[model samples]
Target: MVKLTLIRGLPGSGKSTLANTIDAVHLEADMYFVNQQGEYCYQPDKIAQAHQWCQQQTEQQLALGHDVVVANTFVQQWEMQAYRDLANKYQAELEIVCCNGQYSNVHGVSALTIANMRAKWQD
Candidate 1:
């Protein structure tokens, strides 16, 4: 049996950090922001593609009988629902963690933007 962990938080939140501590196959779309020079580069037009890649990776890892962890800014329940479906499809145990700690610079996300995201976070 496999397990899937969905770690959600704002841009500066420690979602990725927490995912690392869990000893799972961590996946984060922000990784897509990285450029060939190993620098972070945010591309507005590629957000959907980044997410699609993450989803595909999750499925592949699950099919290989490995546990997975997804770290993303899932401020709304709907944003994380697809992972739930994937977990069910693979009969994998699913877990969700909401990281609320205030962090900055780790992803080059500004404090103001993180605050704005917090304000819009769904309950």
Candidate 2:
């Protein structure tokens, strides 16, 4: 069966790590910031664009009938709406995985940013 797994967590959590371990096409909004030199350059102004790219990539993979794993800080439920809709459209089994492990995030997100996300986090 086709599957789409979404890993959600705050920065420093194990979302990306868990997503990597899954046998599927791994995707994340953070990926949109990675330059050709294999470096991550985060631009706050492009955050929404990054998310749109991620969603489009997910839809493309689903269209090709590939299982996909997307890791993002979906702190609020609304952030996941697009993925949920994609899963439905593709008739893929959808799974939401929450990772709360305290592993150091590769992107070096600030504690303040993490705190703000935690404040608005939903179950």
Candidate 3:
């Protein structure tokens, strides 16, 4: 069995930093949908494909007895439930880290704003 740590936050929310600190396999959703140049260049058709790839990678890491760290803005309840289902199916422990912080003082975005952005992004 593998351990899954789902780090949820918005863009520039330090999800990557947390993933790095844990030394776990980082599955960055932004990398799939956004470019390093901070551009949203992903095609709608490719989103599902990219998510599938992420799921596969997570499973592979778990199979190898490695902890998987999903660094993404999973702000929706359904999104978090999906991860829970995945963990249950794989017999892994699901750990959800809600990366919410003070947006005014923080250099990154806020979880509430991220959630709103995600809702719009999905629509």
- TM-scores, all candidates, are 0.91, 0.98, 0.70
Off by over 4 Å in 2: none
User: 45 in model 1: Cα distance from truth in Å?
Assistant: 1.3
Candidate 3 lDDT, tens digit per residue, 1-123? 578999876676577777888867888654576677777565767866777777778878887888889987665666667667778878998888876552432334466865686675421
TM-score of 1: 0.91
Let me know the TM-score candidate 3 reaches against the reference structure. Answer: 0.70
What pairs collide in candidate 1? none
lDDT at 77, model 3: 61
Encode model 1's per-residue lDDT on 18-72: one tens digit a residue. Answer: 8889988989888888889999888989999999889999999999999999999
Steric clash pairs (candidate 2)? none
Candidate 3 or 1, higher TM-score: 1
List the lowest-lDDT window of 10 residues for candidate 3. Answer: 100-109
The 10-residue segment of model 1 with minimum total lDDT is 102-111
Cα lDDT tens digits, model 2, 1-123, are 689999999998899888989999999999999999999999999999999999999999999999999999999999999999999999999999999999888998898988999999999
Better of 1 and 3 by lDDT: 1
Report the Cα lDDT for residue 92, model 1: 99
| Model 2 lDDT on a 0 to 1 scale | 0.96
Q: Runs in model 1 with CA error above 4 Å?
A: none
lDDT of each: 0.88, 0.96, 0.72
